[model samples]
Target: MASYYLWRSKFGGLSVPEAKRLKELETENGRLKKLLAEQVLENEVIKEALRKKW
Candidate 1:
């Protein structure tokens, strides 16, 4: 119990609303990263296709 409280205080533990917002932000970040990665892969494929000789 003491250790928990100490850790919480050291990290400035989030309240309910803050925690919820943090979770939402994390989810959105993950989604955006996935989209960006897909886009990068598509771009690489296109570049490779263009670079091929006839």
Candidate 2:
């Protein structure tokens, strides 16, 4: 969000260190989102399977 950019600017005006950290955080966020999405998909599949039997 906007707060993130403001914090980054205070550190070093988006210098190499800030950029590297940002990239690392972004990658972590992406991995987490993917994991969450996969879980949701699995839940949906399980629900559908149960619905079919019931």
lDDT of 2 by residue, 12-36 (tens): 5677887889889999999999999
Residue 18 error for model 2, in Å? Answer: 1.5
Q: Give all candidate RMSDs, comma-separated.
A: 3.7, 4.7
lDDT of each: 0.86, 0.89
Off by over 4 Å in 1: 1-12
What are the TM-scores, per candidate, against the unseen true structure? Answer: 0.75, 0.70
Q: Distance (Å) between predicted and true CA of 47, model 1?
A: 0.2
State, as a TM-score between 0 and 1, how close model 1 is to the true structure.
Answer: 0.75
In lDDT terms, which candidate is top?
A: 2
Whole-model lDDT, candidate 2?
0.89
